[model samples]
Target: MSETIHTGGCQCGAVRFKAHGDEFASSICHCRMCQKQTGGYFGAFATFADNKVEWSRGEVSYFVSSNIAKRGFCKDCGTPLTYEWHGDGVSLAIGAFDDPDKVAPNKQLATKSRIQSFDTLHKLKVREDTYGVEQSCVKLQNFQHPDHDTTTWPKE
Candidate 1:
């Protein structure tokens, strides 16, 4: 069978990568460090072998988050991209993937640090943002990079 190829990058399209082979695993981390890095309640990631990843566009900037690990992100857009734990394979942020639905997280980590509100998030009431607003008056322009790879960014 052919190998599975996973493509992903930072929000600004400054850093792109292609991961070869099947993903080793997928998980959502609720550790405090993860929450801080992602600026969210938790971080979802898909693990892959180091050798299988290739930086196709730009290099990733890293922060030494701790003695055991470092976090990778885009310097231009500050998009959290990877979590590299010492001696462990790289884990790419699930939201950064070109097709995030492809990598469904099968496990949760650091549950002790999970926010209590997270469990009730689904039960919260949902409402459309345009409830009383005029749809035509709301002119939305998306500046964020597209979900697929692009030859050039910012359309210069």
Candidate 2:
């Protein structure tokens, strides 16, 4: 079972959040709106009660994608963070989690809208981490936020 509390944020460290308690649902959505928002084939999300999430840093700007739903993203960096439905509770982006594997999805939705490429993703070539170093492309420094939270970001 996953931990009771999980934390994560945007790629730029502009936003951070903590999710507490069990999720109502966890799924990968293949809807067009989700795809366009994430600039990917699908959007993975974990549904939780409104009170379950606490914003530990930065605020999110919401885009009204449809009459019944709105998308929440980092206002500064435009990292897609959430999806809220009219009647359903909020859903946090799986990619934004510090440990996405821990909160693995048990379901998938809007499968008809799923692109053909997604079904064949497993056939793609797998590369090891050493590939970057071997190609002399490994970064000497990483400016992105670490997986865990910190007292201050972008430490000097």
Candidate 3:
């Protein structure tokens, strides 16, 4: 495991935070709720131990996205930031950091909702299950295919 890494804030620099410990699970979620919350085709998250995270710059505003989960964002820019689950620790948005490359997504969840346009972004092919566990693709380029295989994802 890599040593804990510190990440910088958003565009205005009002929100700075640190994530300690190796990122355990990283994923892209294409669920409708995630799409609505993030205003994107999918939401990317990196999980970390609750005790390992420290907010250094700004306080986060939260929305109770579910009975057991709360979604956090920067109060200043409204950047969809973190997802906190009671007793489960936190998941931070990969795009909110200064360097998202430090972490790699282990799988993709709710792939059924993945945008079709994503398939064309790169030539990389993805080997995935319906559960969205991608065994082959590593870089973001793989998500460019508009015709991604979503067979393993749960159906509505």
Please provide, for model 1 over 1-156, each residue's C-alpha lDDT reduced to its tens digit, 9 standing for 90 to 100: 899888999988999999888757999999999999999999999998889888989999999999999999999999999999877589999999999888879999999999999999999988857764576647766678888888998778
Writing each residue's lDDT as its tens digit, candidate 3 over 43-148 gives 8888888887888766888999899888888786777888788886788888876678776677889887788887786877785645544543444353121122
Native-referenced Cα lDDT, model 2: 0.89
Best candidate, lDDT: 1
Q: Which portions of model 1 miss their true places by more than 4 Å?
A: 132-138
Tell me which of candidates 2 and 3 scores higher on TM-score: 2
lDDT accuracy of residue 136 in candidate 2: 65
Q: Which ranges in model 2 have alpha carbons more than 4 Å from their true place?
A: 1-3, 127-132, 135-139
Candidate 3 Cα errors over 4 Å, as ranges? 123-156
TM-score of each: 0.92, 0.89, 0.71
By lDDT: ranked, best first: 1, 2, 3
By the lDDT metric, which is better: model 1 or model 2?
Answer: 1
**Per TM-score, what order, best first?**
1, 2, 3
TM-score, structure 2 vs. true = 0.89
